[model samples]
Target: MSNPKTKFSVLMSIYYKETPEFFNKAMQSIWDNQTLKPDEIILVKDGPLTAKLDEVISIWQEKIPNILKVIALKSNLGLGDALNIGLKECSFNLVARMDTDDISMPDRFKKQIEIFKEKDIDICSSWAREFDGDETNIVSYKKVPKFHKNIIKFSKSRNPLNHPATMYKKEVVKNAGGYKKMLWFEDYYLWARMIINGAKFYNIQEPLVDMRAGFSQLKRRKGLKYALYELRFQKELLEIGFINIFEFIRNVTIRFIVRILPKNMVKCIYKLLRK
Candidate 1:
């Protein structure tokens, strides 16, 4: 393995609702266990956090006070804005995104960085294994396309890349116009924009993170409001020239049908849809 001297930053955003215990677990996975340690971690506090959350941050700060850079916002700015703010403050050219509640594998960063060197990659992500209370008992695995061409083509029907498991160049994302405050589809919006702008996408075939999925994941996908969010995202994509009118109508219709279906049915469909 060839190790380069280049350093990268971990850009993450956290809000008040997340628990302290989960935060600690995620930190350990992202920081403690990485074969290639992050030089800097830029954490954005979306808003005022609870005392428990503060306590968790304190513990991590105590461990690596100098490396942890906290960007505190006065009020909740949502994930997209919080991340966009954090992105600018990152000290490195390359930044890896970490969700506050997920556990990345020990060799995740190492493998991703190695690919960045051996390939002309602008963005890199990996498959993720979904788990309930534990990582050992995986519920499912999510896979995305591995090459830029396939990724662009796949964007027509679903998200081309996994957001939480993704790492990309700071300049590339910035040039692509960064993230938008689009309801629940912020990451998808950014990916669509980036793909249209000719960004190189690569997905490591390995499962890089143990994603948290259970009742909460299912619950979030139900309801009419969520369906409206899907429609809203498709409309924006149409406006941005990412999709033609024919593709837009077809996608929205399909998504709306899935949205109204029974949760269990939708779950089965999701599994079948993702490769």
Candidate 2:
């Protein structure tokens, strides 16, 4: 008998200027995982593809056969727009998110599929580790909140689920209106919408991917634009009753501590917790 729950599609949005080696590694990790091969892999190239990237993608297209679907965008649309395009093109009912620079564990899909079946969940995610160049460390080693109510509260300050480690029901995602083209923090915005619509969410308590850390465009910005975005989202949650006054204050306090702490101290604390 065919397993209904086994059908899944992995969506990855890529932009130009990414290292071809990292891109190859990310795709290879998905293909190498044996428990459940993705029925379709949607690769949305956000803008005009570079010669090297095109060659790298062409090789994978041939190697992976027709299961790999490549969509090249004529103009550069940000990550959020590219992801929306990929989501719309996904053929399977189960949609999993992947990053162009991350490495997934071999059993990542198998474990996520098992948990989705067992919990009958609409959205699922797992813990992840972080790497800075040659140095790697466990960033999170516990379960993220599962229930919609709890997840919303958790999202008031930090992103409750790792975007690259998430899988969701396509229908649920569509109903939530898919990814929004927010200036920054598209994933968090999508999660907020999903919770608003009462989607069931779960986080399997296991490390599933190695996410590259250090500075990115969003992290490099000055003037607290990202902080303002978080504050706006928190206000929205407050209006909807997801977080109370005390919880909001607590979340803000934690965010301040994280922002003010030195990088070495934060790493030290993370190491001590993992030990």
Candidate 3:
């Protein structure tokens, strides 16, 4: 209720395989913990979830009544499509992204809204503290540059913002072509398009969200399939002129090598890369 004048919508997509306990905690962080509550929370059920997940949604629905909106999909659509669909249903111009298994700091929205009010930026995300079993036990910090120009330079090599900790202008996202189906690089791909379209970007230096990260998450980053996805995404960026041939070549070569490496090596590399 701190920034009641600046209303925004929370957009999240959850599917099966996510535990109910994590989902409940995510829901709490967005509402119960936040200083500036969202006008509406758009929960896109990517597909049929477990009875337990459904039960948790039911409990929240009754608890919040009109504030929580559920858009259940008939079948499983991946994160990009699910978010694109949910984006259109959002009631506000500003939309904050959340994951089903992450934790947002209590002042996350308040801080981001202040940036939007003061700057001419379209999208912004803060640094995220990656944790494992408990929120207090921080494993690493996924940090990004603070200014738009630095962010633009950084995007050529890596994602310049944390997706789940982001709050973006809905129209800016739509104008940049929204989210696309880019497998493991969905968010990064959309960001490349937005950068090409000259959308302003910023990142807060402090960690505004606590992201859940572990060995399983690191393992998912490897394998032949993920390497292929990275290759395709880099090719798309090159084709769109977002990155030059040399940049594309460098990206593909490094990312491909990392993806095909052993999971333990990948973990160490990621740890070193992150703060």
Best by TM-score: 3
- lDDT of prediction 3: 0.93
Task: For model 2, state the Cα shift of residue 96 in Å.
Answer: 0.8
Give the poorly placed runs of model 2, Cα more than 4 Å off: 1-5, 135-143, 146-152, 214-223, 235-275
Name the best candidate (by lDDT). 3
lDDT of 1 at 189: 91
Which parts of model 3 are misplaced by more than 4 Å? 1-4
**Tens digits of per-residue lDDT for model 1 on 120-234?**
9899999988887776767678888888888888898888777889999999999999988998788899998888888899999889988887545866887788889888889
- Write down the worst ten-residue block by lDDT for model 3: 214-223
Candidate 2 positional error at 14, Å: 0.3
Measured over all alpha carbons after superposition, the RMSD of each candidate to the real structure, in angstroms, is 1.6, 3.2, 1.7
Q: Residue 139 of candidate 1: its Cα lDDT?
A: 69
> Candidates' TM-scores?
0.96, 0.84, 0.97
Lowest summed lDDT across 10 adjacent residues in model 2 is found at 214-223
In angstroms, give how far residue 44 of model 1 lies from its true place. 0.6
Model 3 per-residue lDDT tens digits across residues 214-254:
55578777888888988998899999999999999999999
lDDT of 2 by residue, 206-253 (tens): 778877753332144323455565566666657766677887787666
Q: Could you tell me how far off, in angstroms, the CA of residue 143 lies in candidate 3 after the best superposition?
A: 0.5
